[model samples]
Target: MRIFLYSLFLLFSIVSHADGERVNIASFSQNDINSWQTKIFSGETHYAFSTMDGRTALHANSTASASGLFRKVSIELSQTPILHWSWKVDNVLTGADERTRAGDDYPARVYVVFSGGAAFWRTRAISYVWSSKQAVNSHWRNPFTANSQMVAVQSGSERVGQWVDERRDVLADYRRIFGKEPGKLDAVAIMTDTDNTGASASAWYGDIWFGAK
Candidate 1:
């Protein structure tokens, strides 16, 4: 909810392996490993792609102002890293969003949590679309809020708006989508709505670099 260090607004990131295969956005510096610990979950002013303000029945589009909207960030990669980032989502056609609904809407996620936190996707590692308005290479059938999940990877298409590049190999993408082998990944989160769905989504992020191979 609130954890601040500002660490002078952290600025010093690494993109090693001699920066070979195109994935170096200003040599990484998304507030230095997401500022050790940050999680908003609910709202209090934070936007990069919809933070929150409530509407219902749909007719909204206002979320892009969180200085660097971060749902959660805190990394500790010691050896076993290979995660990349770059997203751009826009438009899913009026009324309800996050994938579709007129009365009970919900859906929107992108996660990776491993601090032995017990559970939140059965060991945490989700890339979601449980239900709602979908488009742009859309394909549905992933309803997992944690049902003894062993892995849930979604990315065969639907880069949402545009600009796409999400190459994850953080220990085989968490052992092929949460199967096991998450000794230490610490933290990395970017979520829009996951408190039990209230779709009104929006997104835009770019270049998140990792090392240790």
Candidate 2:
């Protein structure tokens, strides 16, 4: 599980840029995802371009598997701290406790990674997740590492099978969770994993971007 966490923060050579006021991350609506790369741990979670709600989206399906799609990018939070995206889940995993390693599975999650540079251990991340049981707005340290904080941005089956828009001020979230200033954003990732719970889950992700608040 620790390895899975570490891989999510691995720095890559590719770097992306922002426009005047927005940094476009995943352009799934354009059917363009060439900037993203896959990282797998345990079994593979299938990801493909698909249509959802009359628009192009990225679909992820996991069956007792762990995998993610990430893009290495550099963004100054002082300029564009707001992260925006949309997602929908088929259903929440049954009998899953997000606070434990054995049940550390999420139907959908978006990660924002901060590079640690030379001292790799200092690298940190914030996982904005669609929780199965955790309350919306509740947060806790990841089961495998404190460096990664899990925030339940969405919860339960009340809104299953429906597209939900999400927005987060990454800079404020990092400050709240770590009690310190954060470096430039290094990467962004999305995953729908069920390896720990040994269950099945499915989700669709719309376009992702960062903009000024």
Candidate 3:
């Protein structure tokens, strides 16, 4: 009987491990923003906790501003490779060409950064953006830097004012975008900016998490 019980325990452990684990990056529902830091480029984009769709979320309002909230956390891509999040935009920008620096603005974007450490120039990033003009699933190099790439996860005004859930295989995206294996993920950031186009934008972000496939 003892041996049988031990075997049953082992089987349960294996099954639980196979189910994988989740790492929470943001818990806006619980009003948690303890570890996030703000980085401003042009001007500050106002961020606040607000109730939306019967749940709490982070709301960003940008008017000719460039700013983002970032959290530094090391994530092992081999373990938790999938990123999950939900967002909603009030409207997509008008007359903004995402392919040029002069029009590099987004109403909503969630990005992952891989640190280059001492060699800062080697740092790379992948931004999943809600584009105004680009087609969904299309990707391009950021006009500001080749080190960063942009993927249009959501596009256009067709889905405006509605919450959209997104999931991405970060490991696969990194391999495809950089043509190489990625190291540990250094940080995650979210931004809603219209500084370049000198326009205004608003967005709401739900909780974000990383999980194993």
Candidate 4:
């Protein structure tokens, strides 16, 4: 059996922004990493800093492990709902279905978590992932929890080893999937994992932020 690591979710100070202002969720610099905390599940994924395309990025290396660095925040989606970031993976995990527990792994993924409020059961999340076999733009419930949805933003090996930028409207996506207005966006997380498949993967994540049009 594979070993696992479990810990409490690390919470950070909430960030407030004015209208039309860009809010950086994670700078990923040495100073920023000090505030960002990691949660481990099924071994540990090594994370460090590396320069890519003339900018600093958080490099993740996973060998049959699952872990992620996350920061909590309070953002009003109506004002700045656009999430922007960039990531690159060495290659896709062959034969991983992503919709099955045994195949729930990804070369790269980012998560936006919403609070459940008093009910707690109302919590929800959107995981934007680079799928290995699933078609791009396809979305489904996470194998572990229906409250969390997986959306395949990037797929296949077409852009392996190359930096790819991404943008998504969290406000629109939340409404589309959950059929209701979203509460304050509670946190943002980045992960590169292969624990379920017992494989290895590597990925790099650039600056992540939320902004207006």
Candidate 5:
């Protein structure tokens, strides 16, 4: 078996307020990457800040590499279940099949990780991705790990280089996909990678937050 070492760095905490109305995950408006830590998987994906239409956003450039920025967070689905964010991809990866491990590369994705405590085997995650070929609104088990599922929120070159906003009811999606209730969300992460296809990709990420319906 191939040993994969996953490194996790805690940059900051994103906690819901007592009223539990909303939780801010990343402060992109402040052009800050300080509260986000980098984790290298294959090589490295350059992450920084750039201005788009006068608004600051996180930019990522990858050349056959895999890495990401993540933040430890605690969000209650019972209170705030909706997740909101925006992203833009310069181009879609060619000849990439999201169902196969060798084709497991994306231009942009945001995911949530859940911990299973002592039963670490039960840990699972849901990733929202911009797919290269998969149809929009489609989902499948990650080719590398069954515990992590991927959902194609955006697909093709239809929206390339265009900023698109997205909102999802994470609690509902999790229940539908996992067929069970989920524990507190352990973390939230963003990634743009092209290691599998050996292609280059660039993307931009806007402010991310969670809120009540």
Candidate 6:
């Protein structure tokens, strides 16, 4: 739409780094790549998992919450950073927890915990795809907020179904939601379990990295 085009237009072409370097820490390793993230769930192939055509995730008939995140990079709690990525939903089913909560998300989500330290555990949901009920009428909305009642993660755009980049400042995002500065960003986690009901669901992730501007 005109909005996305405007976003592309208004978006800063100026590199955050004057030296023209990308600010990435750790990320998903395909070949001999490694970083500092820990495994919350090591995924395996099963009924919930299907290898059709070469895609990887914890979908129905796949394993447990084994969605992986590597290059477990950390962003300094200051210097307002941006987290960017290109992604979209492939499918949606039910979930592990069973009973739907605010999200009503079946084939649940893969969340990232952005705690100040290992002891803190505040998370950002990767989000859900359009259900037969909800049309893709809603485009992307920055600063999506979620709570106990329902989730406000739906954006308005569906095309650019291409490799679109989404950038978010970790500091500003956390402060807006939690209402304060953060501590030490411990580790980033990728969780693909189910709803609290435990029906079995998941999401997919590609190269994920965090850095400064």
Winning candidate number (lDDT): 2
**Number of the candidate with higher lDDT, 4 or 5:** 5
lDDT (10s digit) by residue, model 1, range 1-213: 011112112321321233443323221223233332333434422332222122111112223211113323344444536666655445332343332222222223344445434332233443432233343223332333332121223332354555555665667645655566665443344444423233344544444556554
How well is each residue in 1-213 modelled by candidate 2, as lDDT tens digits?
355446745545648597958899989988899978888887999999999779789999999999988888998999999999999999898786779999999999999888787677888889999998788888899989889899999999999999999999999999988999999888899999999989999999999999997
Candidate 6 is scored at a TM of 0.49
TM-score against native, each model: 0.24, 0.96, 0.90, 0.91, 0.92, 0.49
What are the per-residue Cα lDDT tens digits for candidate 3 across 1-213? 002111222222111111358988889878999878777778889999999889799999999998888777778889999999999999898786888988889999998887766565677888899999898888998887788889999989999999888999999999988899998787788999988989999999999989996
List the pairs of residues colliding in candidate 2: none
Model 5 lowest lDDT segment of ten = 1-10
Give the backbone clash total of model 4: 0
Give the per-residue lDDT of model 5 (tens digit) for 166-205: 9999999999999999988877889998888899999999
lDDT of each: 0.37, 0.88, 0.83, 0.81, 0.82, 0.35
Ranking by TM-score: 2, 5, 4, 3, 6, 1
Whole-model lDDT for model 2 versus the true structure?
Answer: 0.88
Model 3's alpha-carbon lDDT is 0.83
lDDT of 6 by residue, 5-86 (tens): 1222222132222112344442332421344333333343132323323543222233333333323334454643555543
Q: C-alpha displacement of 178 in model 4, angstroms? A: 1.1
Backbone clashes in candidate 5 total: 0
Error of 1 at 22 (Å): 37
181, model 3: CA deviation in Å?
Answer: 0.2
State in Å the error of residue 50, model 3. Answer: 0.4
Lowest summed lDDT over 10 consecutive residues: which window, candidate 1?
Answer: 1-10
**CA-only RMSD, every prediction:** 16.5, 1.3, 12.0, 3.2, 2.8, 11.2
Ranking of all candidate structures by their lDDT, best first = 2, 3, 5, 4, 1, 6
Q: Which wins on TM-score, candidate 4 or candidate 6?
A: 4
Runs in model 2 deviating more than 4 A are 8-10
